[model samples]
Structures are given as C-alpha cells and as structure tokens.
Target: MHAMKLSAAILALLLPLGGCKLVPTDKPDAETAAAQTDEARMAAYADENWSTKVLPVIAEHTVDYDTLQKALSAGVETAGNSYGLRPEGEANPWNFVVSGAGTVTEAKLDSRAARMEVDMNGDGKPDVTLQIGPIIRGTALRDAMPFIVFTDFRDQIEFAKLARAMNEKAHAGLDIPEGDVIGKTVSFTGVYTMRSVDDAPEIVPTVIEVDP
Candidate 1:
C-alpha cells in the first residue's frame, strides 16, 4: 500500500513537468514569417506584372538619351520630376526609362556580369554602358516604377530581394547574342539609376535588338 502510494506520488510529480522541454521549438514570429514569404511574393509580383504593367509603364515614360541628357543638364531633381521615377518620401535614386541606338565600341563579355560600351552619337566616343547579363546588377528596374513602394515590403532585406528577382526577370527575357558585338549596332530601351547628373549611366536593358 505504501509502495503504491509512493508510485502515485511520483506520477503526480512528473505530470506537471511533461510540458517542459530541454530543447526549444523555435517558432517564427510574425515579422520572420513575413520575411520568409516576401521573396516569393515579390517574385510573383515581378512575374505577373512584368510584361503587362512594368513594360507598359517603362514604354510610356521613356525619354530618349538626347532628351534625358538635356533634362539632366538642367539638374538631377529637375530631370527626375520631368522624366524619372522615385518612391515618394524615400531617398531612392532617380531611375529613368530611356531608349537609344548605338554602335558597340567595346564588348566586355568574358564575365558573367558582362557589359558593352556603346557610342550613341557619331562622335565615336562611348557614351553609355549597357549590361548584357546572365547576371544583371542593380534595382534600377524596380526603382523606375512608382507603383512599387518601400512601405509595402516587410523590411529593406525583403525589398532588396524584389530588385534581385526583377533583375533575374530582365536577364531571362533578353535575347543576348552569342558573339562579341564590338562592331554591331544595337537599339535598346531600358532603366538606369543616377545618383548625380554627371554619373555615367549603365543601362539594364529590357529590350536589346542587335542589327545583323
């Protein structure tokens, strides 16, 4: 009877400790859950709207290189208000949707993040740098659209992933030719970001048509 009572007392003592665990089951908080999902959400946003919305906005807002140069000569903010896009209340660098036809003066195609120097004017000087990428850099495309807002994202990290996803989309959509395009003429419409009016623009092309 005493042994039975002792066993029952031990069983009662162990019952309260059943919920206690030596290892914690780490549960993600709301912000962490949102952060995990934000990349795919942004990628889906890029995929669904890239062709229908993003491209049309770019086409509508496009300022030719000559026109952009003239506007930038006035001032960076002046040019941004007239022909570029920056998120309201954010210090996002002004991004421009621009178009130009140029002859390739130099092709740096050895790297995955390759670029070309193009002579836009007949002056024979390379005027702009154009990215030809299996790897595209920068968030110029994402920044060029006023519809994409910073506050819409969970955090800066999540917001930056949108840029990465957008770049991947741009690279996948382009039909980059296989050889060095040094002497070829190419017409392009793309996005670029400028911190200063004097900054040499490196374009991330949405469309690049190389002449045969």
Candidate 2:
C-alpha cells in the first residue's frame, strides 16, 4: 500500500509537468504592415518600369507616317504588317506604334486631350489626327508585341489595369490642359491603331515634346 501511494504521488507530479497550454499564433501586425509597404514599393517600381522601358521601347520601334501610310494601304494580313502587328490577336486590326512631331493644327477643347490634329509632314497640312483622351482607350500599346502579355502583369485583369494606368500616365505627360496645345509645335511618339485604310490613322502618343 505504501509503494502504491509513492507511485501515485510520482505520477501526479509528472502529469503536472507534461501539460501544454494552447497559445493563439496569430499574424503579427508589424509583419502585415511591412508586407503592405513592400507591395507598394513593388507596384511603384512596375509603373516606373513600364513608363521608362516599355513605352520607350514602343516609341523607339515606331514607324514613320509614310511607312505606316503604305502599310495601311497594303492590308495588314499581307506582308505589310511588318513591325510586330497583333491584328490576329484580341486587339483587332493591329496597333501600329508610330512616331511623328509637327505643329498642332487643332485641339478638341475639353478637360481631356482628345482629337488633336498633328501636321506630321510639316507641309502646312495635317496628315494624321491624334486622340488625346480624358480616357485614353485601347490595348494596342499593350499588345503591340508578345512581351507585354498577361505574364508581364499580375494577371489578365492586371494586364488591362496596366493599360489604363499607362494611358493615364501618358496623358499626364502630354499635359494639354484646357486644350491649349493648339498651334504649338509639338512632337509626339505614340501608338496608332488602324481598322481599315479609311481609319483616320489617329496616334495615341506615349511621349509628346513641345518644341515651341
């Protein structure tokens, strides 16, 4: 009986030592805050990368008006679609990255940069009309090539979002407030989408430099 009591006392002492308390392991507030900060930085970097690298790439590869005019004359399906045309893709008729600079003959008066005509040839004649938008519409710039696919962005939705962001950023860079760019000698490098030869080869310039 004495031995049994001794054994029972030892068991009781060991049981108390072998206990585990449930502790709630939750996400730390600091960790979440740090993660958000990092995400913001990454997003800012993406914007800058697109503006500096992607837009410029499109600009550098832009075809002149004469070449573009010819290409449009020849159907995009033919040998004309030379500079990475994405006509068969989602953005139909293809988005042509075009570069030209000349006097702004007219500006559609509005808060946004819409329907600004440019005399690209400087022959005292306006060859192509450009669209500067309160909302710069189209996915031509994004799909002008294969590199700027959904893989470049976070997802399919992000890809579209990137396009909108790019347009907004491009418009901001042009900075034609109150349609005051009229009669100014401005050079622009932007994207052109042509649905047909009849399509008014409107340029949506990613870059615009005011000469005078």
Candidate 3:
C-alpha cells in the first residue's frame, strides 16, 4: 500500500512536467487566408485567363510597328490615345500592343534578365528591344489589356502580384533557342510601355518567331 502510494505520487509529478500544447481556438478567416496566399491566387488568375482572354485581346489591338512609330512621332499621349491603352482613372503610362519583323543586332542571353535588340527600319540600330527573360521587367502586358483594372483587385499589392504573375506566365511560354541570336531575323507581336519617346521600346513578346 505504501509502494502504491509512492508510485501514484511519481505519476502525478511526471504529468505536471509534460509540456502544454497550444490548441488554436479558431481557424483562420477567409480574408486572412486570402491575404496569406495573394501571390498564389494571382498566379492562378493569370494562368486561367492568359490564353483565353489575354492573347486574343492583344492580337485584336496590335498595331504595326511602323504605324506605331509614325504615331509616336506626333507625341506620346497622342500615340497612346490613338493606338494604345491606359487603365481608366489611373495615371499609368500608355501601353502599346505592337507587331513587327526585325533583325537581332544584339542578344544578351547571358543575363538573367535577357533581352535582344532588334533593328526594324534597316538602320542597323535597335528600334525595339525584346525581353527574353528568366526575369522580365515592368507590367506592360497587364497595363495594356483594357480588361485588367487596378480597381478590380483587392489592393495595390494584389494588383502588383497580378502583373508579376502575368510576366511569369508570359516568360514560361517562350522557347529561347541555343547559341548567339545576333543577325537572326525574328517576327514578334508584343506589348510595350511608352515611358519616353526617346527610349527604345522594350517589348515583352507574346508571340515571337525566329525565321530560318
């Protein structure tokens, strides 16, 4: 009886020594969960709409490179209002859907943010730069699309995520070839922002075909 009492006392001591586990009283709310997965949600959004909506709209709105160049000569805002799009109620720069065939004068495929300079007017100087990226800059594609609106998203961060997701989706579609691309002819249809008339347009190509 004494030994049994002693054993019971030891058991009680051990039980008290065992660490307490925290049990959450409530599960995360829907809004909180969404905030945590903003990037993933935007990625899924881009994937769902890219082929069905984005590409078709871009194709429909594409202006010939030569025509756009001529329009740009008039003025940035003039060209933008005539041929490009800016999201309504936003002071975002004009984004253009442009198409052209050109010769690659320089290819910086070695860089993580790879790009190629293309000479469109036979001037042997770069007229437009094509981003061939593992990393792409800007939200030109997203901004150019009339259907994608900033107000439609949850917040600025979510809208920015949408832009990044679109860029990632676009980059995944490119089949960059091996070796140097200098002197090669390529035809492309893509989007660019008219940040400045003097700046060479940097295009994020949706469709780029290398000629034999």
Candidate 4:
C-alpha cells in the first residue's frame, strides 16, 4: 500500500513537470518580417507629395539667365567647399558648365517627401531633381518637412543597391548612351527644406537653363 501511494504521488509530480515543456508559438517568418520592414520603409519614403505642395512653389519662382547662373554657381560652390580640405590636383572652385536643358520626367509621392525630374532644357534628356515641401500649410509646422534635390548621377549611386535588387527581380535592362554625359539627368533622393536667398540654404535650383 505504501508503494502504491508513492507511485501515485510520483505520477502527480510528473504531470505538473510535463506541463512545463516548451511549445512553439506561431510567429512571423524571416521573409515576412523582412517584407514588413520594407513596406514600412517604402511608406515612410512616400508619405509626402512634393509635386502638389513644393513644385508649384518653386516653379512659380521663374527661371532666367541670371537665376540659372546664380543657381549653378551655388551648386559649384557647395561641391567645392565640401570636405573642408582640398585634395591634390583639384580644380579651384569649379563651376558647372551649362550643359543644356532638363525636363520634369516623373513625380512620385513618398514618405521622405516627393521625387521630381525636370529637363531644364528641351533636350530629350531629363535633369533629375527632387523637391521637398509641406504636406499641409503652417508656419512652424513647415519646418518639419524635409526637401532635397540631387543630380541624376548622384541619384543613381544613391539608389544603386536598391535599383540592382529591383532589376534582378524584374530582369530589366539598362541602356548606356554615349557622348557628353555631363548634362544628362542624374538621380537623387532625400528630404529637403525650403530656404530663402537670405538664408543661403544648400539647394539646387528647380529651373536650370543651360547656356549655349
């Protein structure tokens, strides 16, 4: 009888111990988690519509010879002044030569702001430009928005890894055209903030007209 009672007690102890065994719970897989992250990032990049808010503001400013010269000079100065220390054999305060014209190609709204491409001149080539502006109007609130513009070359490098991944998935081909590529459209992506001439903000002009 003692043995029987002991066995019953042992069984009861085992029952509770068995309950402690770990059981796997349903969780998102790695792929699912990655996809979720990508979706979130893409959404963040597309939240602002620059065409509706910012482009009109810049376009209204108008482009002329004087403005184009000023803008080009600004770009050159910004690039030259970058990194503080000048490298060996670097040209002294280089300036962007008027390559030609650029036109607006596509404007997509994203979380970061909006991406726009404009062909400053009427050539087939489009000058890549990005515009950042307020989603809604408010004085202090406007400061929160980010606006940025990039050259097509710069944009291409910026999106290189992502573009490559996209190409791999879509199996699309890229064309390489010949001749003077200086004026060719470049790609850029980033948030931008608007600043008046007095502030001397580092911004590429929206309207660029290349001089012949």
Tell me which residue pairs clash in candidate 1.
none
User: Model 1 — which ten-residue stretch has the worst lDDT?
Assistant: 30-39
- The true-versus-predicted C-alpha distance at residue 109 of model 2, in Å, is 5.5
lDDT of 2 at 6: 100
Candidate 3, residues 1-212, lDDT tens digits: the string is 99999999999989965787777776568666666688888888899999889998897899999999899899998998889887885477889999999999988888889888999999899888999786888889888887887888888998988988898888789877668778999899889888789988889988788776
Among all windows of 10 consecutive residues in model 3, the one with the lowest summed lDDT is: 26-35
Structural RMSD, model 2: 6.1
Task: Tell me the TM-score of model 2.
Answer: 0.64
Which portions of model 4 show Cα errors greater than 4 Å? 13-69, 78-212
Query: Candidate 2 residues 115-199, lDDT tens each?
Result: 7777867677777776677577676665565455565455666566666666665666675545377778777778866666666
What lDDT would candidate 3 get against the real structure?
0.86
lDDT of 4: 0.34
* Pick by TM-score: 1 or 4, better one: 1
Worst 10 residues of 2 by lDDT: 37-46
Report the number of the highest-TM-score candidate: 3
State how far residue 208 of model 4 sits from its true place (Å).
Answer: 16
Error of 1 at 54 (Å): 0.6
Residues 37-94, candidate 1, lDDT per residue (tens digit)? 6667778879999988898899899999999989898999899889988777547689
Q: Candidate 3: give its CA RMSD in angstroms.
A: 6.1
User: Model 4, 1-212: lDDT tens per residue?
Assistant: 99999999999988988669688876678655555544343333333434464444334322342344456456544533331112133442221211223444554434333334555446654433433322211121122222422232234444333222322211111122233334345332121222322322222332322222
Per-model lDDT: 0.86, 0.66, 0.86, 0.34
Query: How do all the candidates rank in terms of TM-score, highest first?
Result: 3, 1, 2, 4
Tell how far residue 147 is off in model 1, in angstroms. Answer: 1.3
